[model samples]
Target: MSDTPDTPPDGFEFVVTGSGVELAVKRSGEGPAVLLIGGLGMPSVTWDISGLPGSLVDAGFEVITYNARGVSPSSAPDAPYSVADLADDAAALLDHFEVGPTIVIGYSMGCYTAQSLLRSRRELVQALVLFAGLQPSPISAMVGEMELGLIDRYGEVPREVLVFEQLLTTLHHPLLQDPATVTGWQQVLSAGYDSLWTAPEGFRGQLTASQQWITSGEPTPEHLAAIDVPTLVLAFEHDLFFPPDLCAATARQIAGAEFAQIDGVGHGGIFTGPGDSAARITEFCRARRGL
Candidate 1:
């Protein structure tokens, strides 16, 4: 909701990659390291709103968050992008900060990059948390293509319609039922939709990256089973993006990965009301670290 991509929070700095890309990075608290890979078109600062980083920081882990390439203030080199490229950027960021074998958390779209991280740079991750992330769903893929098709056919979905569609899938029935809550979020989402989100082609970058993932058949069952790190697969009860069933399936694929579902929430609820998610992350990380 904040338009200050150029102005990050205290303890924030930029990490320039060998490829000459600049990543706007933020770090908080102190202890062991936890790197968070954000969702599509999601700003790193929003992690603070989720109360996730502060909660983890309070629990004795330094939290690191950053805007991926194509997200504003970070280099958006080209229109279409690859998760491997994005994961490499994440690796470079972690390398710059000298954090390793750290807990890696990914949500929604970021989950793809996180998977790539495990396959490509296993040394950087100690424990894994896949929040509302999974391989591919036919229905989800259909929706993505439909949206892109609509974009190509027409200009962009009407702002009002886009907001409505976003809510229909993002929030659960309870949040949408609250008149004041919906109105508040509608205003917030719309106000910021064009400025930092679409202005730098962030939204397109996200959509294309996801489409490419669905196309490539990444992190196949074999790939998931091959992951040697401790993994926690987290799902929301009513998430259309990555439902509990799919999340559990992903957990099943990963040897020794634990699965947990947060009730009474949707995809967006994980961040909007993050107490449950934060608790889950802390519990799993502590258990893995023998704390």
Candidate 2:
């Protein structure tokens, strides 16, 4: 592994996945591997800044993270992609490292990939910590459809407009009510808006994947029942995209899976205070895997 100004500080190596997507995989600490799959357009560097990896490392576990196909340091598809396609990338990354059955932590979009990985490549996932996954979000699905339609009808929206919309959708309602906090979020989103502008098709591909997931009726009852491995469905209280009810249903679908909620936060709760989320996740790992 080597470090470059453009990549994560902990260093990363490019792994060629089955789809020929080069994932900039980053591994830290030394112990049982814990792979973290992030949301749409998120990169390894952003995950590092969230402090989740450092928390896990201190808790005595190796943390593996990577930028998805569309993100920089990773290959982007000229065409739109699917959730299963991203799952294939996850499976290939583990195989590339030859890391045996492992604990998986999935946030937002990562949760979808994690579920797909478990269904298609069960042997690779020992456990799942699903955050805002396994639920149907008609709102998001419709919004995703509209967003793509607009882009197709027109072209890429202005960066300023994208950043503004992201900030509004990402921050908690309470945070938005607070002038100071909302401004901080606006600045953050404005500066680090690579997810959308990085590579147009790649960004669109990620959006299309989410849209299809909602339209596809995935995680069917049979699919969830087939999952025999340990699973955790962690939900955020104020997540508009995947409300508590939606998240709870996902947990119920998975036999023997645990369901828990964090109060007073939205979809971006994980980022509002990284350590709190990390601590809860580590707690789950310790109880489930004893590591």
Candidate 3:
């Protein structure tokens, strides 16, 4: 592990080599450990946009974030990888830090990796917070396939444009509907896309990994039912990608898991409108810790 001068305020960066991959990991803050796993095509730095990382830090949690394999600053192997592989990377990070137990937070595609970690490295995960998570379903699989096709045809730029458009048109969140907010978001997204994604091959690798996991036929209801850890499932009311009902259903499979919906927000709400997201997560983590 190494720390450089360029590390963000109060946070230090290090490289953890495990499972034939070198992951770029960042750690910050104090108190209970909170491990954040981001969604598809998102690097750890993307979390800065959501403000959730800072909020979590202020809430007295040591926030841990990382760039998964295939993302820049992390070694990308040529071979295809699985969700379990990603979980191994997370476990490796926790081991490197010698953190006893952490609250694992997963967003969108990260939920799969989180679940894998919970199943395989239960000792490392004290609780779970799944944001906009869903079990693999036919509709969701179809959507993934459609996205893969778009990536193949138009590449990442058009795909990013399509996703931005979808967030605006389908979510109907005020943050996205406001003209000024929309323009600001467009500028931010455009300016950061290349930096965050780094390489088209890396993005394609992530897409391939997601597709493989979705089709892997694991993490079924039976599998989820086996998870006894405390879990908080937060779904957005207007998330077209993972409908609230589906998210709720997934929560029900986990024994004694708490399910909630953030009203008037969509899949991108956690980043655009983080008020409810931050509040719900902080409350859940505190409650789990019996604070």
Q: Tens digits of per-residue lDDT for model 3 on 1-291?
A: 112224322344655556556667888789889999988766787677777788888888889998877676566665356788788888998988988888999988899899999889989999998888655456557766776787778765474655475446334566665888777767766676665553566666677778887787656878888987889988878776678897788788889989988887777776655547777888788776632
TM-score of each: 0.91, 0.91, 0.84
Candidate 3 error regions (>4 Å): 1-12, 136-139, 150-184
Order the numbered candidates by lDDT, best leading. Answer: 1, 2, 3
* Cα lDDT, all candidates: 0.79, 0.78, 0.75
Quick one: best lDDT, which candidate?
A: 1
The alpha-carbon RMSD values of the candidates against the true structure, listed in the order shown, are 2.9, 3.2, 3.8
Model 3: clashing residue pairs?
Answer: none
Candidate 1 residue lDDT tens string, 34-148? 9999988788877777778888888888889998877766666645667887889999988998876889899888889898998899888888898887755676787778767
Instruction: In angstroms, give how far residue 176 of model 2 lies from its true place.
Output: 0.8
- Model 2 lDDT per residue over 1-291, tens place: 112225433477877776667677888898788999998887766677667788889878888998888777677776578999999999998888888888998888888899889989988888899876558577678668778887888886567777766766667787889999878877778777764334777778888897887788876788788888788888778777778788897788788988888778777777774436667788877776642
Worst 10 residues of 3 by lDDT: 1-10
Q: Please give the distance, in angstroms, between residue 114's alpha carbon in candidate 2 and its true position after superposition.
A: 0.5
143, model 2: CA deviation in Å? 1.9
lDDT of 2: 0.78
